[model samples]
Target: MSYKPAHAGSGPASNSLRILETVARFGTGTTAKEITDALRMPPATAYRLLNALVGDEYLVRTSDLRGFALGHALSGLVAAATPPTVCTAARTIIDEFRQGVRFAVHLMMFRSASLRVAEEDPDYPLHSVFELLRYPHASAAGKLMLAELGDPALALPGGQLVKVTDHTITDSGRLEEQLAEIRVAGQASEINELEEGSASLALPVQLPDGSAGAALCLTGPAERFTAISEHAEAARELTVRLKPLLF
Candidate 1:
C-alpha cells in the first residue's frame, strides 16, 4: 500500500487530507497501520490524525474497530460530487450493451451509500434521476443499494413510505420483505412503481469483497421487459465483465 501522498510534507491539514484520501481509496477495512505506511507518516502522526477524523465524524471505525470507512459526516461532499468518469474500457462495454437493447441501461453506482449514474442510456432518456435518488423506495436501482446495507432502515426514512405510484411499496414492513427477497434473488425490480407503465430491473455489480456497491439496471416501460430471468442472464454477464474495471 506504500505510495507518496499527493499533498505530503506540508503540515497537519495536508497530512489529514492524505489520510482521508487513503482510507477512501482503500474502501472499508483500511487500518491505521495501512494509512501510516501508505502515507509514509510516523505512527504518532497517523494515530493522532485518525482520532481527530473519527471524533469529527469524517471517518468511522468498522464494527471490528480495526479498520475504517468514510463516515456519514461527508454525505454532503458525496452528494455534490459527480459520478466517477467511466473509463474507456467500461464505456465500450456499456455502449455495446445499449446497442443490443431498446430498453435504457443504467450503470448505477454508489459512494458513501448515495446513488450516482456512471452512465445513462442515451437512446431513451431517464425521466428524473433526482426523484429516484430522493425516494429510494421508488427506484429499483435505489432499492438494490439499500438492500446491500447492513441495515436498510439506516438509509430509509422509515414508517410510511411516500407512494410514487399505485404499485409503489408504501408500507415499511412490505419494503423490508421486498429487500429480503432482493437479497435472496440478487436482483430488485420496480413494477409500475416509479411511474405508470415504468418498470426497472437491477442486478448488483459486486465489489472485490463480494458486496454490491454498484448496479447494472435496465429501465423502461414495463411491457418492454419480460421475465426477470431474461434480463438477469445478460446483466449477470455484464457484472462479471465490469468487476475488474469498475473496482
Candidate 2:
C-alpha cells in the first residue's frame, strides 16, 4: 500500500499537490511529464511547483531522478491527523454482541470530555452521534461520560442545556443530581430525552483511575426501556470484555 493524504483540495498549493497526487495514484517512479499530462497543467506551472515541493521536502525525486515519490514530510502530517483504529479482535467481540441484541448497540470511547463512536450497530444506525456528543446531557452514553468526568459543568457548553426533546434535562442542578446518581450506580439511562420515542441505557468501561474510558450503550424504542434494563448484567459483562481493547 502507498501513503494517502487525509485531506485534499484546490488552493495556492493545488498545482504542487496535484503533481504529488498524480505520483501517489501512480505509485513511485512517476515522471514530471506524466504529472503535467494527467493534471493538464502547462509545463512551466507544473515544473515550478514540482521544484518548490521538492525543495520544501513535500516531495522527493526518484533515486535515478527520472521520476518522483512522496516525501518523508508527509509522515508527520499523517501521524498527527490519524485517529486510532479498532483491531480485528475488538471488532469480533463487539460484533457478537451486536448480532445478539435487538437494540442499537454503540461502543464509544472517551477522549478528554468528548465521546467518539468506536463502533455503531449496523442493523440500527445511530440517530446522530455529533448532536448527542454536543449535548452530553441528552443521551445515556453522554450522561455516563459526564458522570465519570465528575463535573457536568466541564462537559456542558455555555448557556442552558439545549432541549432536544421536552424530556431533555435543561437545568444544570438537576443534571448534576443525576450525574451523582450515576456515580453511585455505575450506569446511566435516558428516556425520551434525545428523541420522543427513543430511550437508551449506558454502562461504563471503567479505567484504572476510576473514570470511564469507554461506554457500551443499548438503545431502542422508549416503550422498551424495561427491555433495556433486563440486559444490565450482559452490558456489564460486555464492558469487562472490552476493557482490554477500548482504553
Clashes of each: 0, 0
State, as a TM-score between 0 and 1, how close model 2 is to the true structure.
0.66
- Displacement of residue 164 (Cα, Å) in model 2 is 1.0
How far residue 163's Cα lies from its native spot in candidate 2, in Å, is 0.9
* Tens digits of per-residue lDDT for model 1, 36-97: 88877778878999999999988999999999999877665766485567789998998898
Clashing pairs in model 2, backbone N/Cα/C closer than 3 A: none
Instruction: State the displacement of the C-alpha of residue 103, model 1, in Å, after optimal TM-score superposition.
Output: 0.9
Model 1 gets an lDDT of 0.82
Task: Kindly report which residue pairs in candidate 1 clash with one another.
Answer: none
Give the Cα-based TM-score of candidate 1 against the true structure. 0.69
TM for every model, in the order presented, reads 0.69, 0.66
